[model samples]
Target: MPLRLVKRLARDWFLLGMLCAVVLAVLFPEFGASGGPMHADVVADVGIFAVFLLHGLGLPAAQLRAGVVTWRVHVVVQTFTFVVFPLLWWLGDAAVGRWLPSDVSLGLLYLCAVPSTISSSVAMTGAARGNVPAAIFNASLSSLLGIVLTPLIIGLFASATGQSLSMGEAVLKLATLLLLPLALGQLLRPLVGAWFARYRPYTNAFDRAMILLLVYASFCDSIASGAFSKYGAQVLGLAFLGAVLLLAIVLALTTRVARGLGFSKEDEIAVVFCGSKKTLASGVPMARLLFGANPALGLIVLPLMFYHQAQLLVCSLLAERYARRPAPPPGA
Candidate 1:
């Protein structure tokens, strides 16, 4: 109802803006340039660095410590978020490999390989009255794990996907862009803690802006690379269906698994948020690393992009619905 809230919604509607950007780019490729539209490939690389810097600010020390102590939640969330998703992606690619272009298959694979998102997971957890600390740890661990694991996963599948690169190269790139900056931020936390407290509002704004820029650059690059030509409406439709289905499946499985492990309803919700969602913020950078500067990245990130927005919208609605309901009548 407030002006600030309205603006926040617009920022989160980044996916819609991205769709519009892509359509415009496809229609008029030279819209942004005096000489010509800026190359999407170049902007993508820059976008990766931008995202990591902002990611550093949100690193959750308390949540991470709590997760390390609990251990079980960590194991369950990680097993599903990292292990299960990647495997399903590979199997899906193998099943549909022949029907889809190799690039589309590869893109889908990359989507599965990306880490869980940090901001949205925590946000949704808070909205659902779930364990915010655990959500933070689940999402943070995914990104850290991704720095090493994603390169390895991609290396194993690269030959099949026809985009082979040594794991070492990708690891080095990820370390430089993501890990090193995060480490520096951690080291500086003590000295800058007061500053962060003082300027928290501004820093938050900057972080949100970086996310928007990354989304814009990623979709813009997709347009410039002629990525849309490779897939028809049919493929896009199927990809959307696949994303929704996979999300639902993962969400249901995570809830069951968490409860089986004896977690409370709130903890189960945290696990669901952390396990079911994928991170487009981290995915784009990882895709660029694995796929090179090729236009195919547009397709590779397409499913994840759509899934990212879908998860947010659906989860937001769900969380709000849950929030509105009264707490179960005092231990009923």
Candidate 2:
């Protein structure tokens, strides 16, 4: 490869690194699996807490309040997050649940149930010159809502699919791993929120690091337990395709809905970005708490990892296209 080409490809170094990390974990399960001298499971727990703490501290109380004031846009965005996305996944479950292990379909549904992303969705909205306030509100609210809604949605799916889980235990784990630290961050936000804001770039990187670690841990455990063998390339490949289809269907639907609702161009951009994407940062940790013990956890999350990458590429291009268009003639 040409030197410039190599560097250009490396522009998305983090995504490439994430793919390589999963591959290495799949091949060397022992390094990531629990019950080792390094105690990966313990480290993962601490990392999860830190990730959400940053979430709480970094969120802006002013933006959140402003978001609530514009409840009209949020109603559509939140509806897509909690309702439209899950309904599509539920349809997928009905259509293909019997074909794969319950874990595979359940994970897809779990990803759907998780909230819209806080960072990328908001940033992309800002890039497209959309409603930044609405983006921030919907994404932040979705994360908080997912703390409870995700587990409940999973519990409902488990009941339907004959998958057994101790809901009480799962909810408790979420409260601890996901919610408590978030609450602490919010509480302490008043004390040191400015400091957290100053270190935004580092804190964002820290969030990604924690997610990568959690993903690595899941794949390690899954591979260590022979989970990949159960899900051959044929099945995993199909899941990736399904994730693409899922995003396409969502994009198409959100665009049509946004237009039909007669939303302004900016509001449509916010709706499309905030409504269509899922939060890997939230999904990965939730997967750890909800499906950590399941051997097929790795396979379950495989679709989500692919879906996350796919959305980022598609949305970036779409946002840029929107940005390039001429602005409305100063409100006509």
Each prediction's TM-score versus the true structure: 0.84, 0.93
Candidate 2, 16-113: lDDT as tens digits:
76887788887778888887555777988898889888988878889888778767689998899888888887887788777766667766777788
Candidate 2 minimal-lDDT segment of 10 residues:
1-10
Instruction: Provide the RMSD of all predictions against the true structure, rounded to 1 decimal.
Output: 4.1, 2.6
How well is each residue in 73-156 modelled by candidate 1, as lDDT tens digits? Answer: 778888887788878877776886667766666666676778888978889889888888788888999989988888777777
Per-candidate Cα lDDT values, in order, are 0.72, 0.83
- For candidate 1, which ten residues in a row score worst on lDDT? 29-38
Query: What lDDT does candidate 2 reach at residue 321?
Result: 86
Model 2 regions more than 4 Å off: 1-9, 330-332
Position 314, candidate 1: lDDT: 69
Candidate 1 residue spans exceeding 4 A from truth? 1-11, 27-47, 197-205, 211-225, 321-332
User: How many clashes (backbone N, Cα, C below 3 Å) per candidate?
Assistant: 1, 0
Q: After superposition, how far is residue 134 of candidate 2 from its true place, in Å?
A: 0.4
Give the local distance difference test score of model 1: 0.72
